[model samples]
Structure formats: structure tokens, C-alpha cells
Target: MELVINKILNEEDFELYLKTVESFDIINPFYKLLASNIEELLNDKLRYFTLKNDDGEVLVLMPFILRKVPYLEDGQVYYDVISPYGYSGPLFNQDMSRGHLITFWKLVDEWYKANNIISEFVRFSLNHNFQFYSGVLIPTLSNVRGAILDEETQWSNLKQKVRTNYRKGASNELRADIVDGVKPEDVERFYRIYISTMKRVNADTDYFYSLDYFKNIARLSKGKILITFIYKDDTPISTELILISGNTLYSYLGGTLMDFFNLRPNDFLKVEVMKWARKRNFKYYNLGGGRVDFDSLYSYKKSFFPNDEDVIFYTGRKIIDKEVYDKLDKIMNAEVYLEKEEVMEEENDSKISFFPAYRRNAFNR
Candidate 1:
């Protein structure tokens, strides 16, 4: 087996990567175009890693974002690798023996160390792809997924509250329309409601995505994205941006105007989106996890599939160079002390659970 790294610079290479992804039957929201768009916004580099057999058939594929470490003035560049924002990790084309997986990871480690990689992080897929990695794994939040194979069964399985809210929205004459394709005007409308929702909840700066970012996503991932709007008469009260992959529909980002909360637009919007996905033969509707496990957000998503089992999300963390990682951790700790005018022992302790302990502050910032 040989490991191939595709930078995906030109159209030919990009098409090749897409073909490989399809060959593996691995489909998720974070494909090349979306990842490239996000990396471009963050000024990072995207790399596609694939392990192929002697016949040039792909066995495993994974995409990573190479982010340069901050505050490193040692005249040498160091980088940390992370999976794309959403659910993604190493995807195997087919079940392999233990020996094959061992060999694959060995090659992966060699490549990371050969490059100037300091650390690696991965967010495993929620669809239960066979993942093999020699790293510390943590069971993160649980995402609520509703199976929508049969429309009748899905509606029958909905929680009473969700059913009631959807009915309420219908009674209020709130209508939902799934945009045929992402349009500039629809993106603007979605951004307006999304920003208002973020501000109402006091979301972090990182979550306040730029309008240009949304526009770029629509442009780059044209066919893979779906935009749905909930309208009251002539005004849109709620909107959701969904990502499509294989047979699943992921509720990527969405928001509801607080003033229209009484209309139950969100609940009604979700039901309509599921129906739309079901008609398209999608199997699952992944309502991602909340800010914290079992929080109000999680509870709200759970209302859709009250009896469905929780799909646990797992994250993998690994430190390639321990010595360099320790040095950076100390530097960041001192910087934090200087900024806060006190030793943040508690904060540091809390951050120990976070991987690459050095960049804990960066994430918070």
C-alpha cells in the first residue's frame, strides 16, 4: 500500500479527488469544494490524503486542514492538522484486516513526522465509519438523527410536542419553501435571520460567519447545498442551510427570528425539510449536537426523534512532537499570565482536557 497526498491545485486533480471519494462510497458535507472554501477564508491549506493499493485503488481517504501555529518565531514553520469543521475522519473503502489498518496508520505517522506537523486532531464521522487511529479518543456530544426512509413512519414517530408545533405553524399560515438551488437573495435572507439568532443567543465571534463566507459556500458547493425558508405572508421568519451527502441530509446552519417564535416556524421548517429530504430518498436527517450535552439545544433537536438512540460524536487527538508541544504550552501559559495579570491555574487546569494544550487559548480567543 502507498499513501498519496493530493494538493488538489488544478481541475484535473480536483476531479480525481472527487472520483476517489465516490469510489469509497464515503459522502459527507465536508467534501473538497467546501473544505477549500473554508480553508481559503481562514488562510489555511487543504490537503487530501489517500491510501491506495498496488492496483491504484483507494483503500482509505482523509482530508486535513494544515494550520500554521501562531506566535512561532523560531525561524522555522510548524503546523497542526485538523479535520474539516463538521463530522469527518478517515474513511475506508471497505473493511480491512487488522494488519492492513496497522500498516495504513504506520504510513500516516511517517508522513506527519516527515512534514513539520506538530499535532493532529480529527472529528470522527457520525455515520459510524470504521475509524482506526493511534490517538486519544474522547466521546464528545451526541447528535440527534432521525431516520426518514419512510415519510409516514417518520411523521408517526415524531414527538407530540414537535407534531403540535408543526401543526401550530401550519395553522398560523406559515409556509416553507425549499429553494431549488442556492441563490444570492436566499443567502442574504438566511444570513439576516442567522445573525439575529446568533446575537439573541450571545454566540461567540467565531460563530458569526461573514456574509461573503455564505455567498462563497453557495457558489462553490452549488449542487451539494439546500436552502429552505419559512415565511409568514411576505416575510421570512426562519431559514435553514442543509448539506447533502450520499443518502443523508445534515442540518448545517439555521436560525429563527425571535419575534416569530410564537409562530413555531422552526418546528414547521424542520418537518418540511425532512419531508423534502425523504422525497429525495435521503435516509437520515442529522441534527447536530448542542453547545453542551443534553442542553436545551440538544433537547430541542431530540424532540424530532424522541425515541431514537443518541449518535455519539468522537474526536481523536494526537501529539506528534511532545518536546515542541511542551515548549509551546509553557509559552502560551506565560502569555496568558501576562495578559490576565494572574496565574490562571484554574483556567489552565480546565484546558488540560483540550488537546494540543498549547492552543487552548487560541480556540477560546
Candidate 2:
């Protein structure tokens, strides 16, 4: 079957494909629903592509943002379909086959070089089947890839680990205080814990989002974000933020004050969260993927979240207009976030607002 690729450039087109892609079970961003006013968020410098056969059967889908190096572009363009958080890649329709893919890639290659974006397409270590995918794409699989999986009948869960750890830690009374009400003030404490954890791991703060970003998401996402703080003795030793949308309650973020490590606060925290979900009758908990098979982080995530959701990722690229792309590559490689930025980053020692209105008012000199 003859195959052709087209970019989504209209409101009608976006909606049509969105409904079509839902059957694939891929997670579409909530922002996508508000495509009209928030095109920047949905398409946002992104180039969404659609592939179909001669019979007009939707074969495969790929959407990427035009990652424009504005300073270097000198007014040129190069783009790759990417995910901001997760589950943003390809959408293959029913008619997908090897032959159609080959044709589509040739077109992509010709298009990329023709556009003068690059010599070839590069996808950042993204897709599982890199061998089959061609054109301008490099799958970036190395950047902390993981899956949400439930352990087999044999593997130990998080609760079991906690029990063992509690014995090891020789804890006092293992109690959990559940707070039904959630507040914005909690996010600040959560950020502190997350920031502290990141510092412990020597991670970059770029991944650490600002409070405004969190506040914006919480406000805009409607009832999608469900946050639960687990406490013991009226003190929050550990807390977990679970993003609830549809049937999945993704164990999104968690942090703890190191002082309560003795009571196995984390283990207890996980169990309580799991119990809440089971009580409320939620389906899945996205424990998230580990860096590699059997990594320590993966092992830790496994204790509470055992459902292994094998998510599919899609990517492709092409040197659309070769003359335009060669310069683009040089420009892309040349750009880098300098190391000095880190050296200059010092923790704020002065009193500042942590969150709530009262806190901000109290801190303001």
C-alpha cells in the first residue's frame, strides 16, 4: 500500500486524530483537550505527523516539537517529536506494517535534508525498536527509562520489605495518620523533601520544578492531581503525591525527613497509600520504571507498585532540506548549559515564603 505522511495543522485534524488514537491506550496530555487556546502546550513548537496508506488507513503516528535553537537558527528550523513528561511519541494505526514504515522513512529522510535541518533524522534513544525505525530519529532511552510493574507471585512487595526493615530499625509503635484534606502548603514541604532528596542524589535542579509550575498544574488539572501526606505522631515524616487521572493513580512524588528513617516511614507510607487506593477502588499504581533491570531504585519502587505497564514510545526524524539541516546540527551540538551555573547556585539562607498566605505574610520583612 502506498504510504504518505502529513502533519496535523488544523483544529479539526487534531481532534479527529486524538479520538482515533485513543483506541491505542496511549496517555494523551490533559492539556491536549484544550488545543484551541493552548496550542503552545499541545503542539507547542511541536510538529505532529500522521501516516496513512493508499486506502487512507491510519498506519502510524508521530508528533514532535520543533526544538528550535532560536539563537542559532538564524531563522531556520529542525524538529523532533518528544515527550515533556511521558507517553508522547508515536501512534501506530491498525494498518502499520514494515513496508509502509520504509516508505514513510524515505520521505522523512528526503524531507529533513531538503529542509536543511540535518543530514539525517535523529531520535534520542527513544523507541524500543530502533532497528526498524529510520530517518532523522535517535531514541533517548538512557534518560532514566522505567516501567510500572507489579511483582510476580514470588517477589516481595513493599509492605513486606517495610516489615523486615522495621525489625531491622527496631521501631516503636508503627502508626499512620491519614489526612483526607490536602492543601497547597503541603506542596512546599513536599518540594523541600524532593529538593533535599535531589541534593542527596547530586541531581540537577532543572528537573526540580519551581513552585509556580506545581501550583499551575494543580489548579489547571482540575481534580486530576490527588496528593496524600502520610503522618505519624502528628508529624509528617514522609509524604506521597499520587496523580489520579482515570483509573491510574501514579505514585508521582515522595519525600521524607531523614530524622524518621528509623521507623521505616517510607514503607509504612507506601502501604497506607496503597490501602487508600484499594479502599477507594483504584485500578493501577504506576510505580514508574527503574534505570535498569533490578536496580536499587527499581527495587524500591517495586515494593508498593507491582503493575508492569509496558508503555510504547515512537520516534522518527529526517533531514528535511539538507542545506538547512547541516547548519542546524552544528547549532544544536554547539549549545550547552554551562557547568558554572551549578557553582553559582547557592541555597537561600534568608527567610522567605514557603507557601500559604500566612507563611508568605509572616516571612515578608
Candidate 3:
């Protein structure tokens, strides 16, 4: 087997990479639609490492974003790698022996070290593809997923509160539309509601995306992007951006107008989207976790699959070069201290807890 690292620079190469991976029955959510858009937003380089056999068939594909550390001296550049946002890690096209997997990981370590990658952080696939990860694994959060069942069974499985909200939305003349392709106006409407919702919740700056990002997603994802909008009378009240990969549907990003919260537009929108996914024979709808464990957002998503087992999200943290990692950590902490005389214990705890602790205050810098 050979390990091929692809850093696609041109559109043709990017398209070819997508085609090659789509040919396999791999469960990957880090497709180009999401990764490429994020790459542009973060100004990071994206690379894919694939293990190919003698027959030239790809056995495993791992995608990551390489971010360079700022203020480094010329020719002494250092980088860190992280899996793209959402549930993504090494995607396997077929199962392999444990020994082979071990060898693959060792080679991966060597490659990262040679490439000056100081640390690695990964959000493993929600499908439990945590094989051969010789890193610190932490249970991050719980993602709520609903298995597509027969219409009768699916409706019966929802929590009574969810059903009541749906009923209320219906009674209040809230209608939902499942749109396969996005238009400029549709993106504008979605962004207005989405940004407003983010502000309502006092979301961090990272959660706020530009309008062009959504436009790029719509343009680049081909037909794999779906937008579900909940409308009251003629005004759009809630909207969700859903992604399709393999047989699963991901509820990627969404928001609702606070004024229409009483109408329960979000609840109605989710049910309609799931119904549409079911009709298309989709197997799962992954409603991602909230900002914090068991928060209001989590409770809302949990109402969909109240009886289903908790689907925990796991993150992998690996320090490739401990010496450089420690040096950087100390430097960042010192910088923080010099800038601020008083530091909250809670903030310090959060910074230390983050993988690549040096980056915890990256935005503040």
C-alpha cells in the first residue's frame, strides 16, 4: 500500500478528489462543500491523506486543515492540524486488519512530524470510527440522531412536547418548504434569520458566518445541499441548512426568529425536513449538540429522539512535538498575563482544557 498526500490547488484537482471519494461507499461528512468553504473562511490550507492499495483503490481518507502559527520567524514556521468543523475524522472505504491500521497510524505520525505539524485535534466521525487513534480521547458532547422509521412509528416516537409544538405550528398556519437548490433571495432570508438567532443567543464570533459563505456552499455543494424554511403567512420565520452524504442527512446550521418562537416554527421545520428525508430513503438525521451539554438547544434536539440512546461525540488530541508544544503554551500564557493583570480562574481552566492550549486565546490576540 502507498500513502498519497494530496494538497489540491486547482479546481480540476479538487473536483477529481471529490469524484474519487464519492465513488466509494464511505461515510464521510467532511466533503468538499463544507471543507472548502471553511478553508476559505479560516484562510487555512486543506489537505487529504489517502491510503491506497496495490490495485490503486483508496482504503482510507483523512482530511485536515493546516493552520500556521502567526508571528513566527521566517523559515521557522510551525503549523497545527485540525479536522474540519463538524463530525469528521479518518473515513474508511473498507475494513482493515488491526495491525495494518496500526502501521497506517505510525506512518501518519511520521508524516505530521516531518511536515512541522506540532499538534493535531480531530472531531471523530459520529459513526464511531475511532479505530487506531493512539491519542487522548475525550467524550465531547451528545448528538441527537433519529433513525428513519415508518411514518407511523416515527411520529409515535417523538416526545409529546415536540408533537404539541408541531401541532401548534400547524394550527397557527406555519408552513414548511424543502428546497433542493438555493437562490440568492433564499440565502439572504436564511442569513437574516440565522444571524439574528446567533445574536439572540449571544453566540461567539466564530459562529457568525458571512453571507458569501452560504452562497459558496449553495454553489459548490452541487445538489447535496438542502434548505428547509418555515414560513408564517408569507414571511420566513425559521430556516435550516442540511447536508446530504451517503444515506444520512446532517442538520448543519439553522436559526429561527425570536418573534415567532411562540409559533414553534423550528419544531415544525425539523419535522418537515425529516419527513422529506424519509421519503428519499435517508437513514439518519443527525441533529448536532448544543454549545454546552444538556443546554436548552440539546433539550430541544433531544425531543426528536427521546427514546434513542445518547450518541456521544468524541474528540482526539495529539501533541506531535511536545517540546515545541510546551514552548508555545508558555509563550501564549505569558502573553496573556502581560496583557491582563487579572485572569479569571474559569477562563484559565477553559484555556488549559483546550487541546493545543496555546490557541485558546488565539482570537483575543
Candidate 4:
């Protein structure tokens, strides 16, 4: 079977591409709908890469942004290879064989070289899990799984701590309601709490999304996106933005007032979201992982699924131009690279792990 590879360039092609495959939570049609919004915000180019059969049947599609690299003379670019936020990777319609994957990468490499793409970074999906990646890049990173619930599962499956917290939240009269369609005011309120949460965590400035960004989310996700709010005495305490795509319910973004910690509002919010998902017959509710390893945040998520291992949150990076990448890396980590060959070696024995270290600080993370 011969496969033809092409880059999607127009709105007509993108809309057609959306119709070719089943929807995904992280890379769904809704996610693609918001691509233009993100491009307008970040001044990047949204491009779709596709591998299709001779009969024009699409097998794999990857939507990514071409972000211009700063400090470059010739306008070099790199593929984000996923949406600006959330999890995304290659979405497949059929089972991809090792040979098919190898061919796909060959096409991708050719396109990368043609576009002068210096490198690429990808965040793979959780629902449509793939155990391996081939060619120039492979996934060495993973996302931890907080919990996985079955349709027939009982509340008893949850950790005692989680159950206790749920009860505590109930005792405090914390109530959660899922919005049918999010409003501008609702997004603003959520953003207020979201901003506070970022500040509380000392997150990088890039985490601070603008109001227009949330507005665009509400507009693009349509009815598939719901914001669940936990309220006490009609005052919002915790809120989570959920995206229903395919058979999985993703707990996308959320925030809670730290002041309501004692009331266990966060725990109650998750319980309510899960109950909603269960009622809808959704197969999985991805609670998502923490920023790092099993820290306090992970501990909190772990309370829900005490016995489960973390889900692999896979990530990959590929460098297209080795010389350009090294030069950029050295420029970014000049303090380490600028020192004498002998003196630098002894002074800094450790090597930097940041991919294309020159663009390390470019991301909000």
C-alpha cells in the first residue's frame, strides 16, 4: 500500500481532515477549532501533517504550530507538534505498524528539513495510548495516572482519605454544578481563581493566560466543554473545566480557593465530576497528573486511586539540525559553555537536560 503525505494549508483542508477520523479529547475537533485563536494570540502558524492512502483515506493526522525561534538570523522555526496547552500527538484512525511509523517519520523528516524546522517537541495523548515511537525521536517522559474508574466500580474502590474528604466537603455543604454553556462572566470568575492558583504555586508568567484565551475556549469547545463549580452558600470555592471528547472525559484545567482547603472543596469537585461522567457512560475520567513526580499535588490526586500506577505521559524531542541546535544550546546556556574547556568541565560537571537548551526558557513551563 502506498501512502501519500501532505501538509494541510487552508481552512477547507483542515475541516475535511477533521471529518476523516474519530474525535479525541486532547486533539479533538474542538481543539482544532481553537487553533486560529491560539495562532492569533501567539503569532504562530498552525499546520496539519497527514499520511493518507492512495484512495485518499487518512490514517494519521498531527496538528501543530510552527513557532518562530527568537535569536535566529534566518527566521528558523520549530513545530510545537501539539496544541499550546494540554496533551496532543499523532491521532491515528487505524493501528499503525512499525513499518508504517517508520515511513511516517521519513516524510516528517523531509518536511522538517524543507521548512528549516530546527527541532520539535511533542506531548502525546493519554486516551489513545501508544507504547512506542520510532525514527529520529522516541518518548522518554511520562505522565502519572491519578485514577481510573470503571462503570461498575464502587465508591469503596477509592482511598479512605478521598472518601473522608468527600464526606467532609458534603458536611460543609459544598455543591457542584456543571454549566451547560460557559458564559463570559463565568470564565472571568474561573480566571480569577485560576490566576490566584498560579501565583500561589509561583508558576511561570506563561501560565497566566489572558481573558481572551478563556473566552476563546468557551467559544470553541461549544457544549462539549463544561465548567464544574463547587459552591458553599452560593459562593464558588473550586472549579474544573472538563472536555468531553470521544469516550473519555478529561478534567482539563481547574483551580480552587486555597482558603477553602479545610472544607475539602477540591475533593468534592472531583467526586462530582466523576459522578457526572459515570452517569453519561463515559469510559474514563482523566484526573491528570501533577507538575512533577509524586509530590503533595500527586498525593492529592493519588488519594482517588490509591493502588494505581502513574499513567505514562509520553513526550518526544527531535533535533533537525545538529550544528544549529548546538549553537543555540550553547547560546542559551552560555554561562556553562563560555568557560574554558578544562575549567568549565571541573566547575560544572553536570550536563543540562533541556532539549535544544537555547529554547528552554521560551516555554512558560
| Candidate 4 residue-wise lDDT, 1-365, digit = tens | 34344334555655565554444224453444544365443453666667776776566666666666665556644432333356666776444565666666678777787767777776667644343454234444334343446634647778788789999999988888888578999888888888888889888877777777777777756566788889999789888877777666667778888989899888888888778777777766666776665667767777776766656666666777888777766665554433443353455322225554565454322
TM-score of 3: 0.88
TM-score for model 2? 0.57
lDDT of each model, Cα atoms only? 0.79, 0.49, 0.79, 0.65
Worst 10 residues of 2 by lDDT: 351-360
Tens digits of per-residue lDDT, candidate 1, 171-280, equal 99999889858888989999999999999999988788888878877776647888999999999999999888778788889899889999999899999988888787
Best by lDDT: 3
Q: If candidate 1 were superposed on the true structure by all CA atoms, what would the RMSD be?
A: 3.3
lDDT of 4 at 124: 65
**Candidate topping TM-score:** 3
Off by over 4 Å in 4: 1-30, 33-42, 72-83, 95-99, 127-132, 135-153, 335-352, 361-365
Residues 129-160 of candidate 2 have per-residue lDDT tens digits of 34456643433222222222333321243347
Worst 10 residues of 3 by lDDT: 343-352
Q: What is the lDDT of residue 32 in candidate 1?
A: 42
Against the true structure, what is every candidate's RMSD? 3.3, 11.0, 3.1, 4.5
TM-score of every prediction relative to native: 0.86, 0.57, 0.88, 0.80
Global CA lDDT computed for model 2: 0.49
Q: Report how far residue 2 has shifted in candidate 3, in Å.
A: 2.5
lDDT of 2 at 53: 62
How much lDDT does candidate 3 score?
0.79
